[model samples]
Target: MIVVVDSNFLQNPMLETYFNESATNKVVIIDYAAMEAFKGDTLTSVVKSTAILRRFPRQVLIAHGTKTVGRLTGTREEIAKAMINDEGTAEFREFSAHLDRYERGVRPDGVERQLLDTGRWATDHLNAAQAENANLLDVFKELTDGIFTKEEISKIRRGEQEEGWVAKGFGLVRDLASDLLSRHPDGSVKLDPKDYYNNFIFRMSLCVFVQLMDWIRVGSPSALKPARLLNDRVDAMFATYGTYFDDVLSLDKQMLRTFWETDAILRFVYAREHEK
Candidate 1:
């Protein structure tokens, strides 16, 4: 089994016990997991030495998030194989080394600045989520041209919509098509939200983010502060890559929920495509 465990599971000591050194199952150490460790207690709490060293001959595959799509591509992962063969992976390995130095009081000035910047972005994301929560019913109308009724929006907020509903209910692909003729188009051709199954990483990331907004809208207890949501966004990265693999092992209910939701979306898209 190719298991993708988010940063949460990476820190859990039990992970080392269950999977062991020579287990057949492969545990994926996504690119974000390493970078995410920099935020909290450095490498000590986020990922333990045993998690990597004890794995012995069993290779810990590092999965990189989609790169060419840039921000729309979501998070990146890099495996050991890539670290050795791919030049891009080498850059991330340097990040790992710098993180190690930071832990030892040799702060990597460049990476440290990047961590500070994430805080600013998280605050912006928080503000946006709050605004969207307030206008979930109306804001979508702007893009969708009022085709999505208030009642339907409410149903979706509650996750009540049935399978294959989005694809059929609205000319989703057409509607989302960018009005490239104008700079301020309803959408951009940079990425297509339709047929999400085909763009597994982007789709999974989108699902996770939308779910966060829904939680904020409904006042779900699981909905946490901006920093936590930022962490969940990291989980989204892992979840996105997880969809392309076998399974995900995460402690956070929100992360697991995001994973399940992404899987359902993938299945629905596949079913819809088959009908044609």
Candidate 2:
């Protein structure tokens, strides 16, 4: 099994226990998790996390990989090291500069206003269309006819499953991903969607949320916390990508449950390839 770990779980203390418990699975680290580790206030603990990540037999993929001198280039340890000893590495310097910008809330094309904007856009459009006399809740039920039963829909509408239902798949969600979600199994859009099933279901959940917000006459978009938006997207990406692998490992209970749900959703939605 390919076990993907989250950023918050990259603590020095939990490494041995995690490895001991997952002695049989091939633990992997996604790029998002690695980049997040650089936020460590102490270089020692960050290095410790990177070292533990690299010890995995499988080379952890760094999608936004950095440059390092000599043969240590692009390794997890190198990424952390470059942050501390950037020296003259232009690539790592530029990357760290962006991190610096993010800390000051200047990340333009990043997660600065990621969830806030997305939730607004979704809620805005839904409200505008509802003003046109369209019943979107009916449309939502029609779209998720099989995935969520009618009883589940009623329960969610009653606010029972509202906690992590949106959060579970909210990270892999984007304007483009939602576009894919809206047009899926339709001939209107010619784009191909990502292979992860959570991507599809999460988008569906967003639509479900939009409907619920309007249905209950509640303003949920206004409730989205801007402070927690950054980490929300990060954790969302980890849980979303975890569906592509066999499993995800995380010390956080919420993230761990998301992993289980998304991975299980992937297998349930796609049988042959992911079936155990």
Superposed by TM-score, candidate 2 places the C-alpha of residue 182 at a distance from the truth, in angstroms, of 12
Candidate 1 per-residue C-alpha lDDT over 94-117 given as tens digits, one digit per residue, 9 for 90 to 100: 545655566668865576567556
lDDT of each: 0.52, 0.44
Task: Give one digit per residue, the lDDT tens place, for model 2 in 1-276.
Answer: 445667666665565466656656544554456445543333333444555544543323333221111112232233223323222233333444554555556757645444245445544543453354334334434443454445544555676755344443243234434554445553323223332233323433433333333333333323434333333434555665554455666766655655565455445445754453
**Any idea what lDDT model 1 has?**
0.52
lDDT of 2: 0.44
- Model 2, residue pairs in steric clash: none
* TM-score, cand. 1: 0.58
